[model samples]
Target: MTPAPGGFTDETFAAFLKGRDEPSWLADRRRSAFGRFKATPLPTLRDEEWRRTDLRALKLDQFAPPAPAEPSEAARAALEPAYRGLDSLYGTGIALVDGHAARSPDPSKLGGAVFVDLASAVQEHGELLKDLLMTEAFRDDADAFAALHAACWTGGALLYVPKGVKVETPLFHLVGLSAEGGADLSHTLVVLEEGAEATLVQETIGLDRGKAPGLHVGGVELILRRGSRLRFVNIQNWDTSTWHLSRERAVVGPDAALQWTVGGLGSRLAKVNQEVALVGRGARAQVNGVMFPTGRQNLTYITRQDHVAPNTTSDLLYKGGLKDRSRLVWRGMIKVEPDAQHTDAYQKNDNLVLDADARADSIPGLEIEANEVRCTHGATAGPVDPEMVFYARSRGVDEATATRLIVEGFFANVYDRISVEPVREALALAVAQKLELGSAPTLASAEAAGV
Candidate 1:
């Protein structure tokens, strides 16, 4: 196998895996993944998917694999509120700090279900993990970052709900980073058996305020069996000094339903690819996302909806607000198979430019091979309307207040559609904070301020 570029190499990966007592099959899989990572080149601006985002300034050699560090009192204290709020709203909570499982759900609450650290899951449910892990959602050859994640992933969570079981309360998973100049590669696997139902909320946060940049490459695989239902929400809030890249995919079985939501509000640079495949007849999926990029952040998102069987359906909507010199890119595609008759799919993306220097790009596409399918896609990018501000000001509203109201209304269409109350409220607050810090004053600013 060829040697890996930068500071990552086969020897480095082998040493990292040593003494872990991992199953031989998993060890071989990692070695194979490392070979793929070595052969795959880092993406460049010339690549079609990477055309809008540039990573020439990044130095991968400077980042080293994460080493377990004692969680600091201050770091734990700072994250207390996040954990408390999640636990209060959701009945189950799991916290991983610095790629270590810091907190997990009790066995009594989990019952026959499996909710534990990845390492433990490997020992307890090796057969299940081996069969589903990295099998479909994330492939070794998907991309350079994905290949690297497959070889270097360390701490993660596994959630498995058995057949006919239904979890009434929601579950929360938190992945946090505190070590500087280190990298955290995590994996999350969620499986719901036939007739099962569950709700999962996941969040990634950076707890350290370090000057040096850190790295986070993560992957998520979701599998739903026949007639299963899953509601998933993911919130990303990494520190400004971190670079985040992730890939997520879900496969829905016959008559299964999935509701997936995502919020992006952190990281210096983030590129995420999220996809869902309706592989069984009558499967359905709904994907929604909201992002707020400020300062010099660069955020790119790619989504795919694949209808593989007849009578499948999918709907997707994404909204973003950009400020300062930040840039946002969204690429979405919907594909219907030749046999997928009566398929229904729709995708839309909207961007709100909050600053003159900010930029937004939206691309939507559809690939259909079936004649009896209905598919539609649309994208829009523009600044907030000044006339709306004027109309609000005419109603005796202050300039700042009017701009805030308009911005809020612009996002309310998406936010109000989120089914989870806590997640919706939290994301709304995040957007408000970004607007307060980065939103440019409207035409009413000068007149209202008596300038």
Candidate 2:
């Protein structure tokens, strides 16, 4: 009902709001965010965070907010291994079709947890939503995308686990976008109270690929209270023609532990910002990332680890592979506040380029104001080792198979750090499929690589 020519203009923004059925508070928030979006300009190559990234070809006006979509079996079927085996891993799940929620868990199955679409949470859990949504974990109008997402986001999910509730089964959020799903502006908010524990898996799939180009501007906020533990895995697998942009942040509280894993393998151009803030003593975070880009795609990740409390610890590892004309970029930082003494942080990013035309860029940094902190970072980018391929070929594997095997070995380390069996399998199988391998990586290859 909205999103005409000049998709993001003030006129279209007002039209978008006119079509939504939201409350006064939400309307006010949208207006404020749109105001900020108008005041802020889109990132350019001149900005520090975007110096290596360019958006000169992106025309936001060409994309419209996705209209509510009907679930299609054909679309789901097209996702193959990425969407496969999901039903067996979760006790309950939320499915979003073309930026609209298709199904939600029965409230009784939540076991005292609140897993519902953000649209409903705004009414059923307004007070808590008001206090936490965009207030704690990812609060900022840093750029145009952030503000635009806050202003026009829809078809998102919220998971709020009560204090002391330990959900043994992982929860799933799956999104399927089709050719007709013009634009996806979804926000995911996950909140775990004190002593609570849960696992949440978020996945995005491009159903009916090679249709019209698409756009996704997404946000994710993870909030863990004291002593809580959370495991979150994000799978981003949109079509190569889509423009994918996202911001994600996690706030870890005292004695809480967070494990975040990511799989990025799709999109024409992606620019993501991921950050973690340790706000309490004894807090810990372990982050793992795996990215494989093929074709002419461009992928970039900007990550930060913020130590805000004493005795906080953080560890991060990211692995990437580039093929064809694809390019990958990683810029990472570890920041230790003056008050956060005894902080321990480490970050590393490694990339493998498989083609002469492909490129990879890795940049790691540290900003420490604390005298008693240990922060370290490392990065590496290069073509695959020729000797490894030669060895594989000497062992009777074909050159192509050998290359795939070596690439598998390259990602084995990060995969080992992932605790979820299904997630690990899905990411591995998805990446393998992208490399033209079958459903699962070869066991011989796994053993040869010592995975």
Candidate 3:
């Protein structure tokens, strides 16, 4: 069997599994996932979850799983431009090029935490990953992209904190792609045991302009044990040529809390599913998102907050801005089970359309089986209030500066919820840079904006 050049065929999968000298347990898991991947069909317009997205533009056959990651000086330098001020802000960090680790986590700052690439974790800490790897966050009958990610995922990380450990300093990860038409399948697993606490921040860098048609199928699993705490932030900043598809899920335990934030600033098209399950009493979760799409880009994010136990609370907010002919879609749901009494849940999504041709869709829903639960959801999408722009412009701010100020204030709602100063500042800076919204307070001629 040999690998395919244009697609992931049976021969390619078989050859891939054979080349890796993995233990039987991991090999068997991959094989099982491969079977599932073969059975599940690719997403299409007919699928309700994918109905709003433009499926016709995605040419899945054009991307092929990339070869194993190898060291490259150019790759390292290419990644440096993104995620500025990372070294001083994070206690430990990992830089990956095409899924392979270019820099591993620092030993000194781990503070007895186990931070290693998934492959190494499989070899050195097999006991820790035995039953907790993919079982907690994913199921056997997952979507095609998720199943394929489980089968072909190559370079990712696993962070495991022992009971009673507290890693006060934030950890960092950078994911980058260097080759055009290449596919990267990376998986992240984070586990915090009883009474443990940690924070993780992840960012992605895609192939530069003139680089086109890349693919990313990724997965993330966060498992929190009793009385634990975790704060996670992920910023997807791939170039406009990349098609990003990912499935992320987290399970919260008794008395635990999880704060998850996301920033969607790049990618030609991105569809993501993020879910958090509160399965234990007194569990809590907060989700925040900031998304901006421009230049014909399309971005979609779906989130679910499931409360399965009594006395659980969840709050979610997602804000997006669109320009050019770009489009943004956000759907959120909060579900409370019959036994989840005293559950409190809320979700809201808002979008600002900066161009007449640009479009935005926001949908919020609730499914509650508990009589005692309180759940509320709301969604709003419209162009920037001419009144707000006018107000800002009245205050010595030119039109460009006024619009920029309005956009920043709109997104600041979520930024204020981020608690971590560095993460908040970095995200704000990146958004300003990507949108070219940072400049002197000139008149910002409509002609300059291609009006």
Candidate 4:
């Protein structure tokens, strides 16, 4: 079957995949995902998840697939106008400029590691990719954007650590969106064999500071072999006018643990699907997510903790704050299969509303087929405690100051889960700055001092 004019087609996408030298299995999967993308209509309000998000004005047809690495000086300069010093903890650094990996920075000085751009690796490491790329081990479902990403992704990163290797430093990947009427499709695959441990940092940003609106669609798959550990953080600070969608999931082998933290502070409309399956006994998964929305922006976050094996545990905590006319919806679920005995799962979603005009929705559910399993799910959506705000204002704090205090306290729960102190401080300062609460000199000093 063919896609609509100007829309992506399986034939074109399949040809592109074949040109990348990908294995026949991956190419076939891309074709199948493309067919699904063509058959499944664009989500509208009629759908449960898309009810709060309006995509009519997005005009996704205008975005052309990104070209190969031939960026103009202007585009190159847009990459890093003010160089952010490289992190000493992350040995390898990769930059996805426009929609391709611009250059391969040296990462050999570090320990045993494999880091390469997806497009480049397709040509250089086709065999290894076929054996370790996006497998059905991660998740079996894909939405529209995920299907599109599978079909048309041009750039991303791949990191692999062999067994018995420990990476002290994280792997840093930067995905940049710079061109107008262009789409950024990136696919990140991280694999850690048994006895391997590593951390990954993913940053998505827009080079266009103007009002131009573009599309960022990405898919990531994480595989953790037995006795491995992985920590992943997604720092999304794109242009406020952009529309972004991402689908990421992980598969845990026996005795493996995965920790994920996400901070969403940009984009006019965003949808994120984060899930993980505990396929092995004693596997653990934890997720801590925080989002603050202002203006007319709207954000949707969905998370799933599926236990297919016995004695697995998963915990999730997601917090959100909305001001102005913005809105946010958070839906989470924890499912235990029939034979998954002794599985423990917990899910909680809390939202603090700062403005009367703003809105927040929370839906938390659980499905347990085993009688001996332990599962609990809860959701809370409401305004800040009026008594607490009044007490602060009664002690000489202005209305705005008191309001910011309440908001900060609301976010403290999720921010504390992040082990990286510098990023946490930076995020807190950024959140305060966005709320226009710069009057709090203490916040600036704390952030500057990296306390």
Better of 2 and 4 by TM-score: 2
Q: Which regions of candidate 4 fall more than 4 Å away from where they truly are?
A: 1-5, 9-29, 81-83, 86-91, 103-105, 137-141, 437-451
Q: How many clashing pairs per prediction, in order?
A: 0, 0, 0, 0
What is the C-alpha lDDT profile of model 1 across 89-138, one tens digit per residue?
67786887766777778667665678887867888899999998999778
Q: What is the C-alpha lDDT of each candidate?
A: 0.83, 0.83, 0.81, 0.75
Q: Estimate the TM-score for candidate 4.
A: 0.90
lDDT of 2 by residue, 1-451 (tens): 2235667877778877887777788889989998998899899999999987889988888876554334465654543333334544567777776666666776666788999988778878888888888988765498999999988888789999999998888888887667666788888999999999999888876766575777899999999999999999987877777899999999999999999998888888999999999999999999999998988889999999999999999999999988888889999999999999999999999998888999999989999999998888999988878998899888899998988888888999999999987777667776777677322232112222334
lDDT of 3 by residue, 212-324 (tens): 56788989999999999999988887777788999999999999999999988888899999999999999999999988888888999989999999999999999888888
TM-score of each: 0.93, 0.93, 0.93, 0.90
Deviating ranges (above 4 Å) for candidate 3: 1-4, 69-71, 80-84, 437-451
Which residues of candidate 1, in runs, are more than 4 Å off? 1-6, 68-78, 438-451
Q: Clashing pairs in model 3?
A: none
Lowest summed lDDT over 10 consecutive residues: which window, candidate 4? 437-446
Q: Show pairs that collide, candidate 2.
A: none
